[model samples]
Target: MSTTERPRILVVGGGYVGLYAARRILKKMRYGEATVTVVDPRSYMTYQPFLPEAAAGSISPRHVVVPLRRVLPKAEVLTGRVTTINQDRKVATIAPLVGEAYELPFDYLVIAMGAVSRTFPIPGLAENGIGMKGVEEAIGLRNHVLEQLDKADSTTDEDVRRKALTFVFVGGGFAGAETIGEVEDMARDAAKYYNNVKREDMRFLLVDVADKILPEVGPKLGAYGKEHLEGRGVEVYLKTGMDSCVDGHVVLNNGLEVDSNTIVWTAGVKPNPALSRFGLPLGPRGHVDTGTTLQVQGTDYIWAAGDNAQVPDLVGRKNGNENAWCPPNAQHALRQAKILGDNVVSGMRGFPQKEYSHANKGAVAGLGLHKGVAMIVMGKMKIKLKGRLAWYMHRAYHGMAMPTFNRKIRVFADWTLAMFLKREVVSLGAMENPREEFYEAAKPAPAPAAPAGAGDKPKAKAS
Candidate 1:
């Protein structure tokens, strides 16, 4: 039979789960047994755990993303989104980036669309906030923060300088804490080059509703992380929330106000909104409901795992926790995707599906240069490390976890060079609008005015 005639496996994302699942499925299935196809809006799969480093120039933005087509050569990669899925017909509606919507029929479906930033209806947040969900945002953030420094140095007005140098980050989770930490370090280095702007002139603030930050690393480490940031002159706001940020003026619930030019919203994320139309069972928080086998509830042919799916925490349940679910993170996503793929292949080939179960392997987080916190779990033994040692573990673990040997080498090389070379502080702000200069110079001159009624009705000529 031809390739098109083979059983079809449709993967609905190109993120960590989608990429690893598709790769695993391809390896497990026999030759010509099934054809794998992955669809996502982006052509590449971004290693989001490395996004902060990319934003801080510790790793090149390109290395943080893995091109789908290049890595999955045997699978069909579609640069489009699965707008809706109809299990009744086993078909999905595909909306390409620049084409009309089309229907794609498949025998198997993998729902791994991933998550989007969770935001509230706050005043001016939509207009002034930036997100760290994708690689583009990381690059944009790097440029934006450095550009703020340039603005602060050139301006003579006190208010402008204050606003430009004041960076406000909302949310104190991994993304929020790590990002503000990395960005603050970058700005500190950048200030050295600016004659007028010094590190003391800038203000860095982290706001979170939770009492402690880095809760994933446990409360003790969280407190340590908090103190570490505070030592670096970062104001850590606890048990508070952002009320408003109108016109770069931040108003906190505690009645504190600051005019900040940069507002990064990394509060949290919810499962992709697109999952609703997929006609699948969703949990309370909008994640696809799945069983231990990674198969969607009530469906054997459909599967989901990752930030988008609500998978049971089997280890937690066995340990006497009746209500436990896996948290959304790269650790589980990587492992879940592997098991999800195995289940898919098993379901297709008349084999028993494997149940997914794994204990939490702890967490590691890097906070700027040579500052970090880590918790290592080895069975019954739990080892905790902090400071420079934790920083090395952060790099070593993530450096090895990074997909593709090519990217791992590139990331390590970037770190090696940074050890001896001065930090990169130049701000390429125009990159955000690269076409502006070209448009001004090349846009068609305004049509010569109809000074002599050039566009008037030519009744005489017509007659």
Candidate 2:
């Protein structure tokens, strides 16, 4: 209860790790024993796996994100970014959304700032490409794609229509593949209502520099996914890199060229570069170097997990590969967060710290409605499935993994509604610039009758 002397746990970033870790810590802590504070740029933690569905309108955008304040009611959630962490002084410099920066002292720190989009210095990428990292981006992409359909539908020029209907997605990982599939399905459905637009008229391209797609599910399933997409009229170009997309003129390494108005980039993600300012020892690839205990190397009070930490994979180590690290994905993130919470509590109470370890379960991905691919690992058995059955498996697994019961019900409701009603093809593109019409109307009325009489009087006053 002491204001200045209470043990303070500072959680940086309110994404997956930050949210679950804080929740776990609070649950394990005795009444008012320690103070937990979470800080992030956004107020909600986005469930990234459902982002594609949100973009495709299978689920509402709001349901895909969990509000940090509402879920972590017992913890203090601050909307800000941790600019720098001074480990020696046990203080972190926090730059809030508004106001001057201040230092917050903490007894323990959790660095879960997560990853940002890993981008190359490709020309025009910054100006022309869109990302799918957040709920906002998903909704924006949905609107943009629909808006493009509107453009193509209304245009008479063949060149303009061609450019408008061409959609290019760079990267063939889970994100890129799932996104293109969902959005393409939505577009195909939307074409039914448009007079000029048809599914065949639209060009959907998936380009990746890698030789294969969906590498997480192994070669066999990956090949099946590639074949399935190609069968759906998608042009899957492997080992193809983008040369430049300047002004939407896509030039590919395979000597292919296309004019497209929409370019979606889901190449990869890198740990948040902000880790450097924290003064923690980072790996060569920029992730905070973490041991099997999920604690930062050489530091007892600082812990890290999720996409930002280079956590050792104990399972892999036991298999005789010592240098293997946990891949940055939802499965590991969720598990590491719970273990991290327990470790933090144990370390505080002088209890022994438990090392983090887990074997790979498998991977699953949904490709639009009634279509998916899955790989389940059961000891020596590896179960691979596709089509409607795999689609159900994907939903069951992720639906259960989604953070809270509230979200589980909402997501299931969205799916239930979809079964009876047709997919919502309407796009609220105006949501992005909702105030445009209002701003035009609210413009100050023309100089109220600064008529000839007022002008003559002003000239007389000049003397």
Q: Please, what is the whole-model Cα lDDT of each candidate in the order they appear?
A: 0.93, 0.93
- Per-residue CA lDDT of model 1 for 1-463, tens digit only, reads 1248888999999999999999999998889898899999999999998999999998889999999999999999999889988888998898999979989889999999999999999999999999999999999999999988888888889999999999999999999999998999898888888899999999999999999999999999999999999999999999999999999999999889999989999999999999998889988989999999999999889999999999999999999998999999989999999999999999998799999898999999999999999999999898999999999999998999898898889989999999899888777789989999999999889966567777678676665
Cα distance off (Å), candidate 1, residue 307: 0.3
* Pairs of colliding residues, candidate 1: none
